[model samples]
Target: MTTTQTFGELDHPSRLLMGPGPINVHPRVLRAMSVQLLGQFDPEFTGYMNETMALYRQVFQTQNRWTFLIDGTSRAAIEAALVSVLAPGDDVVVVNAGRFGLLLSEIAQRCDAKVTTVEGEWGKVVDPQAVEDAVKRVRPRLVACVHGDTSTTMAQPIAAIGEICQRYDALLYVDATATIGGMSTPVDAWRADIVTGGLQKCLGGPSGSGPITISDRAAEHINGRKHVEAGIATAGSVAGNGRRIASNYFDLAMIMDYWSDKRLNHHTEAASMLYAARECARVVLEEGLQARFARHAQAGAAVVAGVEAMGLSVYGDKAHKMTNVTAVVIPPGVDGDRVRARMRTDFEIEIGTAFGPLAGKVWRIGAMGVNARKHAVLTTLAALEAVLRGEGYGFTAGAGVDAALGVFS
Candidate 1:
């Protein structure tokens, strides 16, 4: 006999998240998500979608008319950007520096790109000259890289790489998911042909919506894959140049029609997530992007200062460290997992663990979006100091919090 267990009411602990991503959402974004849903094609709902597109254009700092949201996480946007433009056998040079950079390579490969990689150490940014040299040698159709890879807490320098891609007549694609709202990424100014980000990081929202912007040059590449659905195809309509995009759901050409005045039906949009994305951008713009970035910078510096004061070394190349996340070397003779578990259970605070080569060697602490504040920084530092002491890792009592507070002062 089998027994079916009945579950109790759904509830979760209110932990303070100071991690690489999926941070606490802004209150306004939460409220926006709770609003009543409207039909996808309802005039009111479509108006909101259009407004969201405008809002994200400002967030991406691009004048590209193709700026809009994809109904999935940041990786979905990455795949859409790559698969939409990259035909089978097209050469793509990927800058591999960290986990997300590796992800760019993986997705390009799935899109059938002839993937050539320029590698760097996990905790360091790929040198622009290296990327330029690779692009020159491969003569790729696209150059893909990660702007800020959370796993290593490193932000790659994109301006020079973008210039090199331009010189090579290759489209430049950047996964800016971790850095967009927390740091400055001027897409057009950097000469990026495609830029993609998610709501779960510094945007202060959930992960469903991915905001992406495409320059006219990139749009032309993507539009070449456009295909009218057979059911909706018109007798007089013409097909695009390239082969049909592999994934119908991620096809940007169809998504463009859905967002454009044509109002062509694609998939039903995730309306609540759209609302959340819009509110996320609204709050960032309300606070002023520059001020918001400065806030994250201060918070990140405080975390670094606090860790150093506690006698811990910061990991990675300090010059290329991200403004939102800091990686601290795990003290020798300490169980990193044990310390992190204690911080969660005792203080209800969440930090992150490193990935790949840095795993078990560093702790990734984040200060981003709504958590990029003085209080969040001090609280995380205080909890970390207590946990380290309990774990028998020697550190000066009160030094972490004191040093963090000094940054605010």
Candidate 2:
């Protein structure tokens, strides 16, 4: 005797997403996602798939032949990379600079790898020397770290760490999800064996697709553990000599064969997400990498300058901060959540809250993707100034906006 209520058409508020990620996507990417779906193996769709691989090669600054997309969030790529290459009992050294570093360690542990951690302060980059020391001690098979940990708004310098890994004969894996496209992640120069990113950050697209590049060394290790599924195997198929990778969906070796000329089927491809990822890379290259990096740098500087002018302190080592997100210390008497709520309800802007230790103590303001521009920076600072004033935090009127304008000027 109960009637089911019908919901109206789906709708959402138009927000100026200045948060850490999933920021305002580019119009081009949105349009790309609206295209009609195609069969995964359709010749034209496959051509687009090939193009995506080539496009992300330029985005990641690598010539690796194993560049492609993992059809999930950034963490999916991270898990795939770790599980494929790390057999049980393998050794991995993780540089723990912030929350994401802990994530790396946890994933490696789940892979049954013996993980050795080099812990660093939350708001500071892990010293390259410390990572090198760990590598020397553990003689690990792999060294993993996050390039930019938005949790603390710190960016680890991976070039020196990469050199250390190379000298010790360990593969380097970087979760560049927060830094790629917005900052320079030179895979070749850093000698990074594996790098993974998501479209939600500076790539100016939605989540659900992870872009990844793997060096031949890492690919060979994964191939050794490759096992084609029985459902799709032909007579010529043979399991590799090494242990089969632990996860069926995340096996990178099979994914490679799927992307290769073999056209093997794994999971059904995420067609719309593929469109979005491809367009995301296209938009990035169209803007040019260097210019995009400079834009993110300028936006971050503007936010820092604005907050300082408003008598707010920025968290973390300034020299090692990520160019995309700025962590601002919440004033002692102000309610941090109230401020975020007001920013959303009143001004229609969105900012982020910190994780773990920094939670409730800091606010993360992102200037990423299509929002990393002068207008967006100024608007956020101006709204933040109003909200803080309402919260009874003392600061000179217009100081924040004026300082941000100075950066743009």
Q: Please, what is the TM-score per model?
A: 0.97, 0.97
* Pairs of residues clashing in candidate 2: none
Q: Each candidate: what lDDT?
A: 0.90, 0.93
Candidate 2: RMSD to truth: 1.9
Badly placed stretches (over 4 Å) of model 2 are: 229-242
For all candidates, the clash counts are 0, 0
Task: For candidate 2, give the lDDT of residue 125.
Answer: 92
Per-residue alpha-carbon lDDT of candidate 1 for residues 30-112, written as tens digits (9 for 90 to 100) = 99999999999999999998899899889999889999999999888988998898877899999998888888888888888
Error of 1 at 235 (Å): 8.4
Task: Give the worst 10-residue stretch by lDDT in candidate 2.
Answer: 233-242
